[model samples]
Target chain A: EDQVTQSPEALRLQEGESSSLNCSYTVSGLRGLFWYRQDPGKGPEFLFTLYSAGEEKEKERLKATLTKKESFLHITAPKPEDSATYLCAVLRISEGGSNYKLTFGKGTLLTVNP
Target chain B: GAGVSQSPSNKVTEKGKDVELRCDPISGHTALYWYRQSLGQGLEFLIYFQGNSAPDKSGLPSDRFSAERTGGSVSTLTIQRTQQEDSAVYLCASTSGPSYNEQFFGPGTRLTVL
Candidate 1:
């Protein structure tokens, strides 16, 4: 069975603090891994997609790195505005062929206190 | 260009009542998806539609849930005989194609069942 798990269900960081959120996955095949930021009462906003191990993508203060079994979202000197639930999802295939559906992990709720 | 959009940002209904949620994909996106998010859970994939091909309804939880995409642009998800457990945020997203992992999400519709 394909599954995604995120650790530290909730994390509180002071402004300018740096931390990392983890997303581990067990799937048949690794197609792609995605990261999203979701604010209160709003849908998730796309962040980055990591397709292969050793691949990394960065945007402003956020950087995402991927491995064979898990992905890490590293926040460098995060601010209050960066406080949001970070979701990790993976795209993999089943016997039916390409599984376009995303198997999402319970998101990591992040709070950056100013 | 406008991103994916969902109608009725909020919907309140009784448990036994039926409801329909709509999604309009981006102008040129070829893949549209529907998902459900509960209070403390991750996004649950509901369905996927790609161009003129048959929708992947494998993720749908039950037979009471159904969806349709017309003209390969707008999609609607209908929940019959809704239950209190059905109260959730319905999110819609779209991507260029199956191989594209980057998906654009809309501000979800918050469904409240009384």
Candidate 2:
């Protein structure tokens, strides 16, 4: 069965602190990995998509790197406003040829205290 | 252009009542998706619609849940005989295509069942 797991269900950091969140996956075929940031009372916001191992993508203070079996989201000098739940989803391409659905992991709740 | 948008940002209903949530995909996006998010859980894929092809409804939790996309642009998710357990945030997202893995999400509709 395809499954995605995220670590450290909750993390607290001081303003300006840097940290990394982990997302591990076990799937039939890895099509793509996605990262999203969700704020309270709102839906998730797209962050990055990693398609292959050794791939990396960045936006502002966030950087995402992918490996064969897992991915990491690194936050650099995060501020209080940057606090949000980070979600990771895996796109598993099934043998049936239709692989558009995303399997998401429990997100990492991040709180940046000023 | 504006991103995906969902209507009825908040819905409060009694158990056994039915509700419909709507989603308008981003202009030109070919893939639209529906998901459910409980308080602290990750987004749960509900359905996917791509162009004129048959939708992938494997992610839907039960038969009581149904959705439809008209003109390949706007989608609606209907939950019948809602239960207290059905209370959750319904999120909608859109992407250019399957290869475009990046999905833009809209402000979710929070459903409260009494």
> Which candidate wins on DockQ?
2
CAPRI verdict on model 1? medium
Write down the TM-score of every candidate: 0.97, 0.95
Tens-place lDDT per residue, model 2, B1-114, is 898899899999999998999999999999999999997788888898989989888889989999999998999999999999999999999989783468889999999999
The Cα error of candidate 1 at residue A36, in Å, is 0.7
List candidate 1 segments past 4 Å from native.
Answer: none
- lDDT (Cα, tens digit) per residue for candidate 2, span A74-104: 9999999999999999987655686654789
lDDT of 2 at A26: 93
Cα deviation of A50 in candidate 2 (Å)?
0.9
